[model samples]
Target chain A: MNRQNSNKNNDHRDDFPGSFRSNPFHVPDHYFDELPGRIKSRIEQDKSRKRLFYLRPVVQKALLAAAGLALLIGLAIALLHERNDVHVYIGQFNGISAPDIEATLLPSDLDEYTLVSFILETQDFTGMPSGTDITDEEIKSYLLETNNIEPLILHY
Target chain B: MHHSDEEIIPLIQDESTREKGFDRLVKAYQQEVYWLIRRMVIDHDDADDLTQDTFVKVWNNLDRFRGESALFTWIYRIATNEALAHLRKKRISFSFLALEKTSTAAIPEYNDAFYRSDNAMRQFQKALAELPDKQRLIFNMKYYDDLTYEQISEITGTSVGGLKATYHQAVKKIKKKLSLE
Candidate 1:
């Protein structure tokens, strides 16, 4: 009966001539024995990779925020510096003493004609009484009465 | 560890039981996954790397598993995708080194005393390597893994009728290539 069964198996093989019963591939010694450990290590490595993945965006966001903060601070410093310059410029005029103001006046600004003309232009004549023309002898009498005359010459 | 997917999925889903459950899942499915990739790539180291890659994807994506398919099928799908992608890259980069041209030389000799000396096995592997990628996958899954059409369908997203036809065509091709037609 076993011989007959073997014959039947042979007949089956003959019927399907392309059937393969054996594996052609082979793995190294104890490959499966170490496969579990390798897989565990690979998993640990993958977890580390994932940790880096999670940290990357956070690091990028932090750097971006820091950059933005630095830019804001730089802009604020520039604005404050500009404001200080304006204040110093205004203070040059507003905080000066009278002597310093006179010291800063140009030679042309101190011209007698120019000063008198400026005074005449600025004075309000509406409160003053109207005056008639005065004679030179009247000016001389006033100077003599006030003892403000110099005796050098009425002829010149 | 040898529990059904019903028992395994919950453990993988729960944080407390997740690692142990994954270890058990790997222990159960590693051989199957390895052999599937091994037959597809025909290189041990490549197959091993692809196997690990497949499991890693499974570990990362287990939370999104909806139980629409069997756990093994889901795992197989991941393995299949890895193998096919690896092959696609290998093909493009090494197109000049087409396996069919050097199929005989591609058979690796192992360091063991148990090196395969069978001509039929060598011929079978060569014939298998000559098939198109999907046809080879169908043949390996159907003939070698003894996977059912429904299971293969779930893994491949191919219909049972289509897979049957593909398997039939692959077998015919292999038989003709082996001069057994």
Candidate 2:
């Protein structure tokens, strides 16, 4: 039965349509061959509108909404990132443990297998965004932004 | 058939003969785009609307085209995208996403206006149409357009490995679809 099916499958290649499958498959050449002359008139009708290049107010509002959302997200990210970095700097400056921060504010687990765990755990993140209760993350970040790791320069 | 893209681009750059150059472009690519579109929409009037839109956009934006890739690839890209977008707007009756793009396009599945039934090709076209967009495009380019993998990559913005895999899968599926029929 399998052999018969295979033979049957092999037998079906003799058919094609539109002179396309029979002839060479020249798709572009084929399309152009049948394009109507009405297209010229349509192009002429829309030519002036093309030159306008003006966005309608509704389009402008949509673009503004998109831009606003993007900016807000960017600002939030920058703030969150700054806060996280500051917490890290404070941890480093005060001789706080990387392992402790990883346990608390910073997450260190990076495994593909842990994706579901991360997503499920993220549901708990809305209430408690920062794992640590330290406020004004920017100031702390500013103090610890230095490259040089001095001996215990954490200003508490 | 007309002046090459390289020849036409220069003329389009100049304001004087821009219209003439664009007309040549329309003539060159209209038929291929139309058929690809016709297969997708399965409706003549829809195909006609989309083909005109494709050329009109090309005409208006010819000057904006940077010559980083072959003009043919760029034009095919536009045509395929336009057709796909049109299909999406019209809604694809069949879907083959997780597999290849079109589970339907390998065999001849067109109707009486476009294709005849009882032909081996109809089965293949049907299988081709059933494929996902990727598989369909790969099958179309390789089987129909006879394009090289590298050329196809430039046109479809897919990797050569992906195209080859897709073509193999497409042919395999076509065989299966035809067998079932």
Candidate 3:
């Protein structure tokens, strides 16, 4: 099949007026002489380029990982400092009267809801009797003794 | 100086003789490779750059070349791909109308004393430059380079039948352009 095609192409070439196979282009004198040296230089340059090409991604990824680790460490340190501040502030209030501690530590502008939520979060209720175990009479007696009767009546 | 693939391959595979083998390879095939690219690009400078690029690829990939095909065939394949890629990039940078103008502009204007003597050859080159990149490639390989359709297929990764059709179309176009038909 290739032979047939080659023969056909030959016939096609015969139909042309002039030969196209002869190259009309000219190169500078000694172009071929210098080509090998130029190619060798190019190959050396390419080798250097490829070395940098392979190394660049590894360096970029290492830097990115290091940056990420630094950010996480920074966040953890900030969080630890914030927790320590809260602990030290509370520790300074030891032996102070409850009203005095509240007046000094809490802002006067704090809303009732915020104060209630804050007290609920900080107060320990582990040893307290369950609501189902408390009698109505006990609740009334505790409210009266604590002078919370007027507020309780108004809330009801 | 004129080393065949059989002699060249082993020397290139060895560490000590690799550069020498590569130099011999360049000397042996550089003109053919340059002309192959020159005809496609129509500019000597572009062809020179592409020829050097082709050899650089050959040097870099020689280690993985398992001698599956002839060395010239592999090298020709690389040159063909480089030429096509260069042409494609040129086309992309220009509008369709500008691409046509650029293709014609890329052809040297026959101002040289040698080129001025050959008006017919200049016309032939103009006709060839007017061809679409792949069609011109097929025509150049088949008509000018005297390559078999099978060899062209190996280089282009096109089926022989498809190459034959493209070659015929290219011939028809060139003939019409030259007033031969």
- Compared with the true structure, what per-residue lDDT tens digits does model 3 show for residues A3-89? 123355466566466555566768889999999899999999999999999999999999999999999999999999999997686
- Cα lDDT for residue A37, model 1? 87
Each model's TM-score for chain A is: 0.35, 0.29, 0.37
| lDDT by residue (tens digit), candidate 3, B81-161 | 999899888772312245445554453423331254476765666677778888988888777777888888888999999
Which of candidates 1 and 2 is the stronger one according to TM-score? 1
Fraction of reference contacts reproduced per prediction? 0.26, 0.15, 0.43
Q: How well is candidate 3 docked (DockQ)?
A: 0.19
Q: Candidate 3, clashing residue pairs?
A: none
Largest lDDT belongs to which candidate? 3
CAPRI grade of model 1: incorrect
Q: What's the CA error at residue A57 for candidate 2, in Å? A: 10
Number of the predicted model whose DockQ against the real structure is largest? 3
Write model 1 residue lDDT over B1-181, tens digit each, in one string: 3556767888998989989888888887888899999878867878899999999899999888877777888999999999999989888232213533665345443211114636665566666677888898988887767677777888899999999889889877877877962
Write the residue-wise lDDT of candidate 2 on A115-155 in tens digits: 32333443343365566665545434543463432222211
lDDT tens string, model 2, B17-125? Answer: 8888777767766667777666666656677888888887777777888777777777778888888888777676653333244443452333332334445654555
Cα-based lDDT at residue B84, candidate 1: 95
Error of 1 at B12 (Å): 1.4
Model 2 spans with C-alpha error above 4 angstroms? A1-20, A23-36, A50-156, B94-110, B113-117
Q: In model 1, which residue pairs have backbone atoms overlapping below 3 Å?
A: none
